[model samples]
Structures are given as structure tokens and as C-alpha cells.
Target: MEFRCIQDCSQCCIEREYYPSKKFGKIGVLILPEEKERIEQLAKINGLKISILPRIGISEEENSNPTKILAYQLMGIEPNGNTCPFLDTETSDKSPHGGFPCKIYNKRPLACMTYPLIESEPITLD
Candidate 1:
């Protein structure tokens, strides 16, 4: 199956929620291996005090709960079924001149980067 990633579509945010990152909890954003200082600097500039929690995922144990997983695919729910705070439906401004913006674009997780390319080769993988 060929999966063409979403074109500027943040649909994953539809079902992906975030939490206080285990390590970057105080920065309001999760920190990737190389994004620490950049994210920290950005947070400082924006005055955001949030942590970067690991993005949650559905597991085999939860396979029986299609509703739960479906929620993840449709609502970005937390393990406890809470909606993601970063999701803003009214902000899509994908203009040709550069207006569409994600509030957390820089701090977005690997999952966000790997969208639509789910089975790509490791080299192409996010």
C-alpha cells in the first residue's frame, strides 16, 4: 500500500494527544535527541512553560478496544481519553504566501514527521 503523506494536513493531530514529556516536562514541549536547545530557546522566546511528553500509542493489549484506538485515529485522545490541547481547528492557513502554521511545529514528534510514509525504507523513515 502506497501511503502518500498528508499535504500540509495535520490530521494526526486529530487523534494524537501529548503529555508532559518524561524529560522535557518543564518546557511544554517534548525534546528530541537534537532539538533540546532549539526547543528550549523557542520556548523561552514564547514564554511557554510546557513539557515534551512521549506521544502515546495503542498496543496489542488494546487491540480489542477499537473504540479506544479509533479515538486515537480520530480524536487524538490521551490514555485517559483527554483531547490534545495543541489541536486548533480554526488555525489552518495553508496559503501560498506562507500563513498556515502549527503552534507546535518545531516541537512536533517523530510520529508527526513520519506521516503517510508508514512503511518506507529505514533511510526514508522519519
Candidate 2:
């Protein structure tokens, strides 16, 4: 099977809410073992602030915290909907499709990398 994100469609990122972990709050994300060092190095070199989220911040009590974790939700969906802050719907005049762009494309979390793949450690049969 082929895995590829549809062109110009960040629907998944816009569909759910994401949150960073308390330990690495505002430091980007709780990257996987393989992604840790590279992301850190990038942040240091580029002077970029990184943060981590637990379970993509899909929680009811994300708010009411002292740290004031940045809250972002997709817009125009059912139940509770809001657009991700990172999703810039604005594009440049010279560009063809002007809209929200991912600020951290390179350092995006594993979730973004393995979107269509669901890896299971052990095979299960029911």
C-alpha cells in the first residue's frame, strides 16, 4: 500500500487537538527515541522553541493549567471545533495556493511522519 498525504490537505492536523507534555512543556513535543537528538539540535541552531504534548492534547482538562498550554482545535467540525493556530490560511500573492502552512515542517512529530502506518509490536488474533 502507498502512503502519502494528499496535496495541500492538513485535515488530520486540523481535525484533532494536540498538547505537549508537562516535563517538556513548551519545548516542542515528546518525540520518539529516534527523533529526539535531531529535533533538539535543530531547535538550538535555529533558535526555535520546542514543546511536547501527551496524546495530542485530546483531553477535556487541557485548559485550567497554570502553564496555559496553547490550545488549538480544528474549525467547522462537529462537537467542539477550531482551527489549529499553526495552520496559516494565508498565502503569499506570488504563490499559487495561499493558506496556513506548518511552521515546523521538518521537526514535525512522529505522528506526522507515520500518519497512515499503524505499527504493532506483537501480532494479535481474536
lDDT: which candidate is best?
2
User: What TM-score would you give candidate 1 relative to the actual structure?
Assistant: 0.37
Expressed as tens digits, the lDDT of each residue in 1-126 for candidate 2 is: 897865335554454432243332222222554555665576566565444232232335655443332332122222223343333455542223433455456556565556546543568899
Query: With candidate 1 superimposed using the best TM-score fit, by how many Å does residue 110's alpha carbon deviate from the native?
Result: 3.1
Deviation (Å) of 80 in candidate 1: 5.2
TM-score attained by model 2: 0.38
TM-score of each: 0.37, 0.38
lDDT of 2: 0.44
User: Each candidate's lDDT (Cα)?
Assistant: 0.43, 0.44
Per-residue lDDT tens digits for candidate 1, residues 20-94, read: 453321112223545545554665665555344433335666555332221111222244433333444456566
Candidate 1 deviant stretches above 4 angstroms: 17-31, 53-100, 104-108, 116-126
